[model samples]
Target: MQRILLIDDDEQLGGPLASYFQRYELALTQAVKPSAGLALLREEHFDAAILDVMLPEMDGFELCRSIRKDNDIPIIMLTARGEVMDRVVGLELGADDYLPKPFEPRELVARLQSMLRRRSNSQVQDTQNELRFEGLSIDPARRSVTRQGEAVELTGTEFELLHMLASDSGRVFSRDDILNHLRGHEADLYSRAVDIVVSRLRKKLEPLDCIKTLRNAGYSLALRRLP
Candidate 1:
């Protein structure tokens, strides 16, 4: 069973969601406060996390940032319905995905399943060779990236986006294309999310102009591959 941590202040939300998740082979653990949630994350092994925007102690964005500091666990942020800025900020903070509040339990399960599947697929396909560029080295099997001989910490989503571009260096991937590649579906908000992820990626890969924007076209890997 896949283990998931949910950090939300809704006192009554946890019990029902936990019961629903069980039917899909997901074990859900809940933390009503950010402190408790952070503690649980530090102490336990969870495959992914679900964080609500209106969390206690700190908001979900802050919690996500804190987690990204040391962990690469996939995170799904729950935002207020129709709150575009909330979703955008969550993605900017390194959330892998987001579901608006008052969501269907089935949809949440589907999202969790999709994330787990992607992680599994990446592990299987990325085991053989490491991709090397001028100043970047990507070990797919280890899911590690090094820039300029220094290890660069990246969220799961960031790593996946980098790996995708590296696999097809110089290919101009449109925002829609990137969103589809990373999340397996296209949504209106996802296009903007792609841009945010790319921006974050560029900063992490700083002083290395490896990703280039193509005006109205898309983005491409601009690095010279080391053979």
Candidate 2:
């Protein structure tokens, strides 16, 4: 049975949702506060989490950050705001998905199933470990990128940016889109920061020239060239 941690202050909603998920054989644990949620997360191994945007003591964003710092487990955020900024912020914080309030229990179940399916599929196909294009390769498991068989050092943020672009070769992503996809929030004052990371990644990938910059658009990986 897949284990899921649900953090929300809505006692009425949380109780029913737990029962609903139980019918599907998903072992569900509920916490009404961020600290309790965080504590549960640290003490147990959960396949995924559903967190509410508003919580006592600490908000969902901060909880998401705390969870992300230690695990790559998929997260789905619940928000009543339903704003683009909220969605972006949730995604930027490494959430796999977000659903606004007043959602149907059935829809939430579908989303949870979808996320679980994707997670399973990703794990099954993750045997390659290394993705090679030209002389550059990325080891997703280790979060490492290499060029010309030489190990290249990258910050977590930079690696994530490169991984996002390279994983979807030839797809054009605008700065705003990339920011949301990578940072999961609005392209704020630090939106241009993507450019800086791209520049640094380009410098490291000089030998391969696999990263292409689209003026006024965003970044894309050149069509994969097998080394």
Candidate 3:
């Protein structure tokens, strides 16, 4: 069973949700406070995390930021507001995905499964070669990146975006194309989602300047192959 952590103040939400998740072979652990959630994360292992935007001690964004400092765990934020800015902020803060409140249990489960599937697929590829560029390196099998011979820390989404562009360097990928590849679904909400990830990836790969953004076309890897 895949263990998942849920950090929401609604004590009532956890029990029923936990039972529902068991039907899909997922174990849900709940923490009503950010402190507790942070503690659980430090002490135990979870496949992913579900954080509520409205929480005690710190909001979901802060919690996401806190978690990113130490772990690259995939995070899905639950927000009642569902504003575009909220999604953008969460994505910028290193969340892998987000869902609005009052969502169907099935949909949440589907999102979780999709993320885990992508993660699993990346790990068991037939080809495990490192994609090397002028000053950057991407190891698909390890899901790791190196810039200028120094290891670069990337969230799951950021790494996937970088790898996607690196796989076909110089090929323009539309935002919709990138979205579908990352989320395994049609792009619906935030069009800037791809832009945010690209921006973050760009910052992380600083000094290399490998990712190039076309005026309106999309983004592509601009680095020359190191052979």
Worst 10 residues of 3 by lDDT: 184-193
For residues 169-218, write the lDDT of model 3, one tens digit per residue.
99999988998888877336456888889989989889878888898898
Clashes of each: 0, 7, 0
Mind sharing the TM-score for model 3? 0.97
Q: Model 1, stretches more than 4 Å misplaced?
A: 186-189
Q: List the residue pairs that clash in candidate 3.
A: none
Of the pair 1 and 2, which is ahead by lDDT?
1
Candidate 1, pairs of clashing residues: none
Which is the winner by lDDT between candidate 2 and candidate 3?
3
The full ranking of all candidates by TM-score, starting with the best, is: 3, 1, 2
lDDT of each: 0.90, 0.74, 0.90
Give each model a TM-score: 0.96, 0.68, 0.97
lDDT tens readout by residue for model 2, 26-57: 87888988888889888999988999998888
Give the lowest summed-lDDT range of ten residues in model 2. 183-192
